[model samples]
Target: MRKIIHVDMDAFFAQVEMRDNPHLQGKAIVVGGNPEERGVVATCSYEARKYGIHSAMPCRTAKQLCPYVQFVRPRFEVYKSVSTQIGEIFKRYTDKVEFLSLDEAFLDVTENKKNMASATYIAREIKSAIWNELYLTGSAGVSYNKFLAKVASDYEKPNGLTVITPDKTQALLDHLPIGKFFLVGKVTAEELKKIGVHYGRDLRNLELSYLVSVFKKRGYLLYDFARGIDEREVECSRVRKSIGAETTFNEDLPLNSEAARQVLKALAEEVSMRVKGRGVWGKNLTLKVKFSDFSQITRSMMTSYPIVEAKDILIYVEQLLNKVDNLDEKVRLLGITLSHLLTDEERLQENISLFEYMESLR
Candidate 1:
């Protein structure tokens, strides 16, 4: 059996803020944008969660929920630096680390550098190191596969560790809520509930054919997960196929209006930041628009050269926007996606910045 450990930082962004400013500890705080500007909550402290605050919640709503809750702008660079430190700690035990995000990762320590026999022990030591060395706490889960390990890690939170051994897997899963199953989102959970599948035991009682008929492609994974069967590997180097950022507006704006253009520019900046952060570049730019009626359309352009900067991305975005026939439509959402990605290694061959390439064109 493979030994996997999933580590997730506890309210990572908020925790980091609290760590830096001692007065913020044990108080309700969030890391995000301004409430008046339709900004969303990126993460909230545990105390803030008591007031029904959560990630992706609008800052205005979070404020309404807890009027005194503190809001701080995101410091992504600082978070990345801390994440690098945490990654170094992971490398001390295992090189088979798969980062899901800056705040969470899965480590396959089946054959670890530390030669630790117990996966649980390794997880405990990792948690301790993060707390003692970094002044931050993390939750860890140990199991034989990625699914269970991830689930176990979430079972407890804000500095807790749980282990799912072979013998205890079935019992724990059988009682697990269907909504709690990995990959089962809100809509899927409601659908399963309608079919009398409220728990893993209920899910397992149904025939595979029935699930497939109901959920189509997703049914297969649900059936396997219900029975504690996952064959996925802990990929050390997972390739991200695309990087994108989007925003949904509180009020719709005319598609061709200046306000829409500004939103698009903001999205381009975000996409550019994320792409550069990953040390990759893209050759394709896709513009996604959702109208007031909830109808959506996407326009894509493939370029001969790498697109890396906000200015370059916006140039293509303007072209894509102009291509749309319904420029007068009121749009509720705008998104930008960069695909046909080239990794850091592949990018070295070109060895030229997008700015320099643009200058050559000039």
Candidate 2:
């Protein structure tokens, strides 16, 4: 059996805000946008959740539910920075890290850099390092596969660490509600209930052919999940297609001016730093602009030579920025992305097919 660990940041966006501002500690904080502007909650603290606040809920409703709740605009740049720090910590233990999102990932530590046999120990150490160095809490779940590891991590909330050993995997799956299964949304759960598949054991009872006829691809996945079997590997061989940095301003910038150019220059510098750090260069440069109205546009230019320096990036980015025809529109977000990348070292590698392996499980 392989060893996999899923690490999820606790209330990522809101938690980052709270960490930076001590006064927000223990207070109900919701990070997204203003309630007056038809904003919605991106994510809220546990305290805010008590008031029936949740991600994707409208900010106006959140305020109505709890009058004193604080709503703040998201600072994505800060969140990205924190995510990078956490990623560095993960790389210390294993190179087989698959980022599910900015806040969560699956790490295959079957053969880890630390030479530690216990995946559970690595999970604990990672959690400790994040807390000590970044002052942020993360939950980890260890199992033989990605599905179980993800479920185990979410079994408990903030700062949770759960391990589902091979022996105990079946028992846990049988008792776990169908709704609790990863990727089972509300509609799917309701449909499952109609078929008397309310739990993992219920799901296990369904015929695979019948499942395939009804749910197609997802059916095969659910059947395997019911049996505590997931053949998917932690895909660490993925390559970065592009590297970019963006900034959303508190105030919108007027079009065709030094303010926009200055912002682009700063973003180019940051993107260049990241590109150089990765020992990679790009042949295409793109400038992304989001207007105050939220509609966005991207202008890109391909160069004969790879861009590795900030000065070269800035030149192309500035040229692309000038190509924007809607100068009358107020720009609220500015970004620069370098694409058509060439890395110093190959990030891609081959893994055995999961389908054949999965057939053995059935």
Candidate 3:
């Protein structure tokens, strides 16, 4: 059996803020942009969570939830520096580290450098090292596969470590809430609940054929997950699938209005900058718009040649915006994404000039 360990820092961005400013400890703090500007919460401290605040919640809503909650602008550079420190600790025992984000990673130690027999012991040592070296606490989960390891890590919060041995996997999963399953989001959980599938056991009881018929490809994953099966490897070098940027407006903008067009232009520029920084290009441009009622829609355009410039992206953005069926609705958020990415090397091989590509499209 493969030995995988998943480590996730506790309320990472918030914790970093609290750690740097000792006076902020034990206080309700949120790390994000200005509430007055309709910014969203990146993360909040445990003290703030009591007021039903959560990540991605609008800062305005968070303020209403906790009137006295402190807000701190995020310091991403410092967090990335700290994340690098944590990564060094992981390298001591295993080189098979797969970082999911700045605050969480998966380590495959089936054959570790330490030659340690117990993955549990390695997990403990790594967690201890993080606390000792960086003054940060992380929760770790150890299991035979990535899915269970990730679930076990999240079973407890803050400073926690949980292990899911092969023998204990079944009992724990059978009682696990369907909402807690890895890939089951709020919508999927609600849909499953409507069918009386509230827990893993309920999901396991459903026939595979029935699940596939209803949930399609996702059904296959659900069926396997309910039985504690995840065959995915801990990929050490994860590829960037897309580059995107988005903004939520303080006040809703009329759909397809000049104001909305300006926002799309800004988002396209941001996406373009990021794509160029990463030295990559893409052929697929997607425009995402969220309405005032929280209804969302996305329109995409695929081109024969790669897109790299903001002007090029804006052309498709306007076209996609025009394609929206709900032009009468007001938009609360606007986002632009470029996918079907190709690296600098790959783009060179394509041998297509941006000018020629634009001409072809016209």
Best lDDT among the predictions, by candidate number: 1
Candidate 1 per-residue C-alpha lDDT over 115-149 given as tens digits, one digit per residue, 9 for 90 to 100: 88999999999999999999999999999999999
Clash list (residue pairs), candidate 1: none
After superposition, candidate 1 runs with Cα above 4 Å error: 213-216, 243-285, 289-296, 302-319, 329-362
**What TM-score, computed on C-alpha atoms, does each candidate reach?**
0.81, 0.67, 0.78
Q: Rank the candidates by lDDT, best first.
A: 1, 3, 2
For candidate 3, the lDDT comes to 0.86
Clashing pairs for model 2 are none
- Using lDDT as the yardstick, the better of models 1 and 2 is 1
Clashing pairs in 3: none
**How much does each candidate deviate from the true structure in C-alpha RMSD?**
4.0, 12.7, 6.0
Please say which candidate is ahead in TM-score: 1 or 3: 1
List ranges where model 3 is wrong by over 4 Å: 240-285, 289-297, 301-326, 329-362
lDDT of 3 by residue, 228-315 (tens): 9999998987657888888889999998688787667666656764565445688899989899999898999896678887789988
Candidate scoring better on TM-score of 2 and 3: 3
